[model samples]
Target: MKSSTIRTFTTVHTWTGLLAGFALFIAFYAGAITMFHDPIDTWALPKQELADARVMDKAGAMMADIVAKHPAARESIGVTYAAGHPSHEVAAYWMEKNGTWMTQAIDDAGAHDAEDHEHGLADFVYELHYDLGIPEIGIYLMGIVSVIYGVALLTGVLIHLPNLVRELFALRPGHNLKRLWQDAHNVIGILSLPFHIIFAVTGALLCLTLVALMAFNVAIFDGKLMSAFERMTSALPDTAAMTAAGPGADAKTNVPMLPPAELGAIARKAALGAGATNFDPDYMRYVHYGQPGAAAEVRGTSEKTLGEYGMVALDASTGRIINMQLTGARDANHATYSAIFGLHFGTFGSLSLRWLYFILGLAGAFLFYSGNLLYIETRRKRRNAEQPMKVRAMATATVGVCIGTCLAISVTFIANHLAPYFGAEPTLVVQPVCFITFFAAVAWTFWRRPAKAAVDLLWATAVASVLVGVLDMALHGDRLVRTLAEGRYDVLGVDLVAMAMGVGFGWLAVATRRRAVEGDPCSVWAARSPRVTATTTPAHDG
Candidate 1:
């Protein structure tokens, strides 16, 4: 790139990064933990110790009983037969536009099986990471930010290239403030280039799918394309235009539907027949149950990454599969959509792939952190406090927001466990509290001493969050001992992690305190700022 272009890119990268750094930091941190979503789920909702339970009765028999009991659910689907809790099995949409669904888990005689379902903490954490602990919309917004972030990344690289050769791993320790930040930012960016690119492309596709469709429409379809796309993607039973009927048949608005277990079995068999490797019917659907041609569909995923992967929908009466083409299936539209989904969610790979993404994500977060520090530090020597008021204001806001994000996340974990007992829904209460508190912290610290605020907040986060874990251990009931002695790793695993977090927090508190004691404004980048009035490091306090 030309020198001018590089400078332009650098400016874009720095500003964009600074703007999004705080949100991205929390996102990346939570995302890293979400990598082990399943394990975490298991840890929070430990297995019921009833794995050996048997499916006593046949699916068909139980399904019969369900239908007989709930006669109105006659147009119902299949059955799910399991003695113990199993991965969701059975497809059943509970729409009563036509009829009610009464799918029952059954033993051999077709009676209902007893099982329990509980929302677990791991799922909460998963939500927190992606959605800023918000509801569904958070995911889409994050995706939008990711797209803007990609633009910033490209620009940043362009600007940094001019000095890339001059400062490869360049950490000028003493008397050089800017060099420390510049080195930190540049190195992490280069190291995680591949990861950043992957996220950028995927994130763009996710957030801009609507835009993409619009472009395609104006360019090729002339604003009319849904019909053709649907035709290519799936086999819709009725494509013909129906003439207006003189009068609709006297219709019952609500009718009882088939039993869930039998509906699941039918859906599972169809899915298996459709060549899905693991045909487990989960979350069944029943549309217009008890009405003429009522449909029952089962949706699921298979091991195949880019092949036929969705569940098969079976005609509840005839047991004929109605539809099965998923995005993974080979078709122009489906393949493209599947790839987009895989890229956005990191679903294309397993735990290892997720870990790689997580590490790169954190590196990306670090990139922004360093970018802010670089901006402030570069002006430190040349510009006094009377430097452009706007520049000073921007730097203060950046530091407060960026550091404040770290503190907020620390608060999230603490609030999660405590909010429940405070007569509040933990996820609802904790997420907003952490975010609002964080915003308040940033605004308050802007005019007050920024450096001191940053240090104090970090310490507070370390203490508050770390203490949550300690409290959990101290208050454990008999369940804790039982879990440990039984060699069940779920509960034990989380306990261990909590303990580790406490230790990590304590360590950070120590390190930052030492930096303050030693008169350094920045803890990690000690050479940049002169020490505080104190001579000793936090390590050597009274």
Candidate 2:
């Protein structure tokens, strides 16, 4: 393409990134915490703290109880396993039509009266970051934004090609107008380029590929694709079919199967034989329970993701193993499918990989935000005031989405704690409230002053999110103290992260406020030139 063509694309890249930047930041920020979903869940629940806790028996008794009450759970659903004591299992969830269903969390031990799900808060934060709080639509839109983001990255590289070397690591903090922003934008983007690339590739693929995949199913895979997928999924055998109470059949013959602990033990043995260790099977299911063909299965995970080797499904009746996919053996087609999901979800590796991704994802968000500033900066002098009013309106929109993201995230942490006391759904309350409050902030900022809006929102995010970190320590200091007392490393994981973010965001908030009060060194907020009235000779006078 010609240089001009590339330039036009550069503009597209710049605008898209800027407009999408703030949301991207929230996504990255929250997503980094989500990497510790299990740990967070641990921090939230802390089951191990129970003085009477015994991990093994808990699994069996819980499963037996859940299953006996919800017997129809046999054929329809898979299982979920945990790696705890007393019982390592919940019966896989079984839903009948719409929302009506029986849970498989327990068997013979008798079932509880609750639904089979957990973790309201963490899951909500995750969804917000990825989907922007909308389900299907939000994810898809973010994907589109990601693709355009790639374009912006390419464009940025080209524009700065000549000066990149000299200004590459430059962070000239003082009075130079262009130099300051130029340095801030450039250094951050370059330092985090790899992160940007990974997120863009993964994010776009996750968001935008569904339709393309559907097309692949149509154009490439024969109509048999769906069936192929289903068959490839493991089967459940320990579940029972509906009894007709035929002429000779005993309707009362049904007895719930073995204790969950025994079945879990069998599962662990099988998984070990299959070359998978740390078989913390916490969920169980019987596909055809009591009918002589019933099969039970267990599924769970290891500490970090790499050793997970995925899940294994086995033959329940004989404790005879049918198929397994724990390690590298996890069949190719299935592996590709799984890998895409893994890479997108940021769950493919060891500690280092996850952290690497966490930092990069945040950088990617910054890239988008910077692209926006570059866009407005490039054009302000030309349009000045005389530019069409709609052009001015667009600037307002970009600022809203970007700053709005920071504001919402800052609120999410506060909302998490507050929502619980109000007897509200923490996730629902935290998310929507964050957004609504953020939108209000943006509108006020825009009407009041766009530049000021940027500065204030940043500060707001810094305070709210940072304070959340501080408060977490303050509220949970006892627990953290216990963690230290017990010499458990994971406890420090939560503590250090919270305190670090608290300190960092506090600093950022102060910085932005100072910048606004002192006047930013850059003409960062310079307005477009005023429009000129066309002069004409008065007909009579002339």
C-alpha lDDT score of every prediction, in listed order = 0.55, 0.59
The most accurate candidate by lDDT is 2
Report the number of backbone clashes for model 2: 53
lDDT of 2 by residue, 1-542 (tens): 57887678667656666656666766776777777665555554332333122433554455444445555544344444445432233444676545575544443353445564533556766777678777559888888777777777777777777677887778876654345666788888877776677677878877776666667678889765654555454433112232232232242344455654567677778777766646666566665554444456565555444334355555444566655656556767556656666766666677787777767666665555555555555554332224344435555665677667666755766676566568875535765776688678768767855656665666676667556656666766777778679776564676467656656656865665564455422233423222333342211110
Model 1 ranges with Cα > 4 A deviation: 42-144, 160-175, 211-257, 269-282, 302-309, 325-330, 381-392, 475-491, 498-502, 505-542
* C-alpha lDDT (0 to 100) for residue 513 of candidate 2: 58
Measured with C-alpha atoms, the lDDT of residue 542 in candidate 1 is 12
Runs off by more than 4 Å, candidate 2:
15-23, 45-73, 84-92, 99-119, 151-183, 207-213, 218-222, 232-261, 282-297, 303-309, 345-349, 382-399, 423-428, 489-492, 518-542
Scored by lDDT, model 2 comes in at 0.59
Model 2 residue 214 lDDT? 69
Worst 10 residues of 1 by lDDT: 241-250
TM-score of each: 0.71, 0.76
Q: Which ten residues in a row have the lowest lDDT in candidate 2?
A: 533-542
